[model samples]
Target: MSYEVTGKLVAKYDTVQRTETFKTREFVIEKSDDIGGRIINNYVKFQCVQDKTALPDKFNIGDDIKVSFNLKGTKWSKDGRENYITNLDAWRLEAAGSLAQTAINNAPDNFVPDAAPDDVVDDLPF
Candidate 1:
């Protein structure tokens, strides 16, 4: 499955050449949320593989962006020990402002119009 996240770009790391034909680049983003009147910040890391490794080059630090990625997990066994790893493989990215505008543009065209002004009245009993 795929998931999307929006946050401010915090860091971009150099691409790693794992082998003759494999490469990967990693980047981090910071997301803040308010919970119980307190603010919490989360630093999330995502990776782009092969051709997508250049994905982060178009954006600068502190730029707000939306990333679309796939959740990947791998299990390995060595020396009678088991280990699991997880990765967010990013495939698509765009500026947060453009993302919001795209959502508005894609809204349904059959939206209902507001009631006529003549039909509106102060009918509240309060």
Candidate 2:
């Protein structure tokens, strides 16, 4: 099955040639959220293989990106022992929230002049 996730790109590694015909590249994304006034962070890594290894080259680190990937699993047996591995195989990448950030960045600056003295507290509903 395929899944999608949006997060800030944290780290990207160079493409590695596993074998003569098999090559892969991996990258990490950081997903953070606020819960109960505390910030939680999650780092997820994904792999791109073959021609897709270059998928992340266009985007720089720290860019918010939406990754579309497929969940892949493999079973390996060696010395009568069996092991399984799971990989998030990313196929496509697109810049996330650039338009919104650009719009907010392009807006005119709003300056608020402080006209009241210190300790003057307004009544605000809590």
Candidate 1 per-residue lDDT, tens place, 1-126, comes to 989999999999999999999999999999889999999999999999999999999888988898999999999999999999999999988778765566557767753234577866666899
For model 2, residues 1-126, the per-residue Cα lDDT tens digits are 789999999999999999999999999999888999999999999999999999999888999998999999999999999999999999998777884366467766752233366745656797
Q: What is the C-alpha RMSD of each candidate to the true structure, in Å?
A: 11.2, 14.3
Determine the C-alpha RMSD for candidate 1 after optimal superposition of all C-alphas. 11.2
In model 2, pairs of residues that clash are: none
Best model number under lDDT = 1
TM per candidate comes to 0.76, 0.76
| Deviation from native of the Cα of residue 81 in model 1, angstroms | 0.3
The reply for model 2, stretches above 4 Å from the true place, is 99-126
What's the lDDT for residue 32 in model 1? 84
Worst lDDT window (10 residues) for model 2?
111-120
